[model samples]
Each structure stands twice: as C-alpha cells, then as structure tokens.
Target: MLINLSGVDKDNYTLSILKSLEKHNSGSLKITVVMGKTAPHINSIRQFAKTAPFECQVLVNANNMAELMAQSDWAIGAAGSTSWERCCLGLPTLLLVIANNQRTIAEQLQQVGAAISLHVQEIDTPKFTECVAFFRQPENLAQMSEKVVRLCDALGAKRVAQHIEDLTKNEDFANIRRATLDDCRQVFEWRNHADIRQFMFNTDELIWENHAAWFAKQLGNPDFIMLIYQVNGVAQGYVSFTRQSENIWEWGFYLAPTCSRGQGSRMGRLALAWAFAELGAAKIIGQVLPHNIASLKLHEKLGFFRLPEKNDVAQFELSLDKCYIKKQFHSRFKIE
Candidate 1:
C-alpha cells in the first residue's frame, strides 16, 4: 500500500498526488492516505481521505510513523522526515513536496531513481491515470522495486547523513577541486538566480541552497557533471554535462549575469573542445529551446548538426571525428 497525506486539501499540488493514488486499482495494490505532521489543514485532509475510495490511514503520532511504513513495500510521503525514513529503509517511495525545503531532496532522489517527483502544475488527469495504470501492473512494480534497491546502493543514506553532519559542523570550503562540493554551491546559486532559474529544466522556483544540495548529490555520479570556467580569477560561466551513455554526453552551458558585458561564445567553444579532446568523448549533444535563436546559432558555429525533434525540443549533435573537424585540426596540428 502506498499513501501520502501531505497534499490532502490545503495544497492543490499535494491534492494531485492523492488524486493520482486514488485512481489506482486497489485490488493489487492497497492505496491509502496518511497526512504529514506539517499539514496545516489536517482536518480537511482527513475528511477528504475518509471519502477516498480506499482505506485512508491517519498518523496520530508522527514518532511511530517509521514503524508503520516498515510493514509496507512502498510508502508515499512528503519529501521530509517520512521520505528520509523511507530512504533509510530502502522503501520504494514517491514524493509530493509541500514545502520549499523538500525540493532539493526530492530532485536528488528522483535523479538517482529512488522516487518519482512530479510537479503539481504539470499533473494532468490523463497522465496521472496513465501512471496509475502503469504502476498497477505486476511487472512494472517489480522493476521499480529493483530500481529502488539499486538507487539505495548508488546513493547510500549514510553519505547524505554524513554531509548533513559536516555541514552542521561548519565544514571548510577549501579542498574542493574540480567539480567539488564548492562547485555545487556555485552551480546551484546560478540556477536559482532570477535570470537563469527561469531557463532551467527544473523551473521549480527553488532557493539557492536547494540547488546547491541537488548539485552536491550529482558531483560523484558519472551520469551528471558540472564544469566552471574561470578567467583572470573571476568565475565567468559554467558548462554542464548529463551522460546519455558511455559514448555520448549531453551538454548545456550558460553565462553568469546574462546582463554582463560581452558574449561568452568563445568560452563555450573552449569548454566544448576540452570536453571532446580531454574527456575522449565520441559525441556531444545540445538542446535549444525553440525561441532561443542565439543559442541555436552558437551551436551551429561549433559544427553541431540537427537531430530528430523529441518533445518539440531542438536537438543538435557534434561528432568528434567529422570531416570538417579533421580539416581544422590538420590545419592547426600540421608539422612545420
């Protein structure tokens, strides 16, 4: 049985989570609702859950919540204490973040495949119905369970716990080298800033610290990478990497303080060139929002060719050994 109370009635977003759960078939998977400790309109959530199709459990004491969740294979909870408990127990959890603090944790968990975190605004009735039908299938549940186990192993609870400990102890910012802890802070700050946050994939309007924490989790994951470019002792811009596979990497770069003077196209080229030559990457991919003509042109200048549109997003590819690239290298690396 999976349950969540955090989104009961007060939060329209949390309500969507409950609605999605309620629509699932209960014969195979018993669905329920248990309100979080922080829910303001707890009485309203309880009333809604009582009328909910399946049995809805209520948490009288938050202290005993963990013991209750342990009896189940999966738990649906707020992206807070309950979620943390689920992570510790290696429970396949789903998140509905009702509070700002949970955004980073929810994102990090989703990144590692531990839980499913969907925004309320993006939740459509048809998609929710589809997800319920999909998860209700026996094979899908089993596959997801296996994925949760792998995620727990990949991002151990102890690592996150230790980070919280070090952070509370006033950890020094030094010793953070290439793609280190400090870089996460910078990347996160960049993402949360008014200008860049609007253009980001998450687009959640999260705090700068949340972005930092999310980036911190990605530093060690090969599937995610961040590189910063510094010139004359000032941080100019950053390049991000998300690996599609062993042979392919997806690239995204942005200049800080977009209003700052001069374009950072040269820095972008240098970064991409280093990624191909130093990283030994075979192919690099980029995506441009349809309206972003400047970025589309910049990618073209770097020899990126178009790929089939997926979800209306413009996809471009740069192959390492293309004829044009070979010619340029021959011109530069030719013997005197």
Candidate 2:
C-alpha cells in the first residue's frame, strides 16, 4: 500500500498504516508514504516509521504520483485530485476526507465502490487492520481495482484516431438499451441467421411463433436482462444476462453480420460494465461451443477464465473480485 496525505496535516493516517503493517504478517505487506514538502510533523512521522517492525518508508515527496502509484496495488491518502490518479492507474484506495472540500468526491467514490472512505476521527489501528485483511485476497482486490478503473474510464471519447485530422469524427456510443416486444422479430431474424444458428447448442432452426412467446416471457422476467445496442440509431447487436444465484450472472452476445468489425468486443464491454456496476454481480459465467475459437479468445481477453467442459461446451467464468480483463478499453483487431 502507498500512503500520501497530499499536504494535509493527517499524520494519523500514516500511523494507521504503520500499525496495520505490524499487525499483519511480516514480509507480506509493505507501505511507502510520500510526505508533504513542508508539513510540520514530517520529522516525527519519519522517526516513527524508522522503528516500525515491518518495512515502511516516509518520503518528503515523489518524482511522480502516477509513476510510483502504478507500482502498487492499493493507495491510502487524502481524497482529492490524487484520487483521480489512483483511479486512472487502476489502483484502489482507502480515502480519508481531511478537509471539508474533499468530502463530496470521497462520498461519490465510496458509493460507486471505487474507494472506501473513513472519517478523520476513525483513523486508527483496527480500521486499518480490517482494510488490510479484506484487500489481501486476490479476488477482492481485483474487483475493487476494476470498479475504480471502470468508473474512471467512463469518459465517452473513443481513442480511434490515427491522425490529428481524424479528431472531428463523431463518437457514437453503442448505446445499450432494454429490448421490448417490438424488437422480437428483429432479434428473431438475427438469432436464426445462418452464422448464429450453426453454433447454437440446439442447431435446429428457431421458428418465429415459438421465439415470440419466449421473447415475451423474457421481457417480463426480472431475473433476465436483454439489451439491444444501437450505433447511430441502427440496431447492430444484442447481449443478455440471466441471474443464476444472488450474485452470479451468465451472459451471451452476438452481432449482426452487417455490423462493422470489432463491434462485438465494444458491445461486450458496455454490457459487462453494467453487469458489474449496476447489477452488482460478483461473478459472470458463460459457455461457448467447442468450435467457437473466436468467442473463446474474446472472452479470455475480457478477463474470463476457462472452466472444465460441460457436455462438450466450454464453460468460462469471471469473478468481479478476480477480474482479469486487460486494461485495453477497445479492441485493436478488425474482425473480418
């Protein structure tokens, strides 16, 4: 963990980290603090750190917050602009509102699962120790990390330009919206597309009459989520989620053959973000046909892990607590 109060008179926060490090198993955790250039308590803090039982360092400042923060899994500091740095670097944090001005963003970050906030008076050994143990698990840390990144990456700008002249291109969202009964025939047509049907578990062609009934049933089921994505107001693909347990959800997605290359991955991201952020899913599970190599690689790149085969179909799962999705927000490859 990296600690930086960012110029606030909050030496207690640093003390909490030191206490937690001592309570935790030695050699398992380390803390490095970036002190303010002129804080009055710098000398005392450094002296305390020197006698710490585990590894701890107190520095007056750092060359770059982003560069150093990237090397750590977690950060603890004042809730301010530095919070944005942690979010951008995919480093989760335990934030404290040192000043009245910092409370708003701190609360917002906490509400969205991006960071945990503590009252100034609450800084102590027990609270810090609790955070240490919880974040030690790979899964919990992974989930918190992604939640912070996704919250940070919510900006709509698509980094697709190859040259300065391309800046004027419109960035249309693959706007994901819920499906209505009016979308039945459109979805049915895509579902039975020769390319889509060949890979289905039940290869028998789906008849519209039966599909309409099933689609209507899904529209009324709260446990199921069906979304139709649009680009420039034209429907291009669809993704759906089905809740298995309280926190586990399964998803499937496909694009219209007429859609542009790379649309699948883009659409998939929108759905996954919604699943983890809005639906509060702890894990997402999926399956692919044995012949679907493209689908398997796409899932893997998005952080899904392969599970044992289920009746010839390949099963995959991604835990929010253990999200391994690549940091790349967009796919670079063009699908033919």
Q: Each prediction's Cα lDDT score?
A: 0.64, 0.79
Quote each prediction's TM-score.
Answer: 0.42, 0.50
RMSD of candidate 1 to the truth, in angstroms, is 21.2
Which regions in candidate 1 have their CA more than 4 angstroms from the true location? 1-177, 258-262, 323-336
Which has the greatest lDDT? 2
RMSD of each: 21.2, 17.4
User: Candidate 1: what lDDT?
Assistant: 0.64
Give the Cα error of residue 247 in candidate 2, in Å: 0.6
Q: What tens digits encode model 1's per-residue C-alpha lDDT throughout 171-218?
A: 221110145676665666676677765566666766766666677777
lDDT of 2 by residue, 1-336 (tens): 788887746455666556656666746667788877877778777887788776777777567777778888788888988798789888988887888999998999999998888876666657866776776777887999989988666242344344433753566545677888988999999988989887778878788899999999999998998988788778898889999999999998888878888877777776777677668888999999989887988898787889999899999999877762322332321111
Count of clashes in candidate 2 = 1
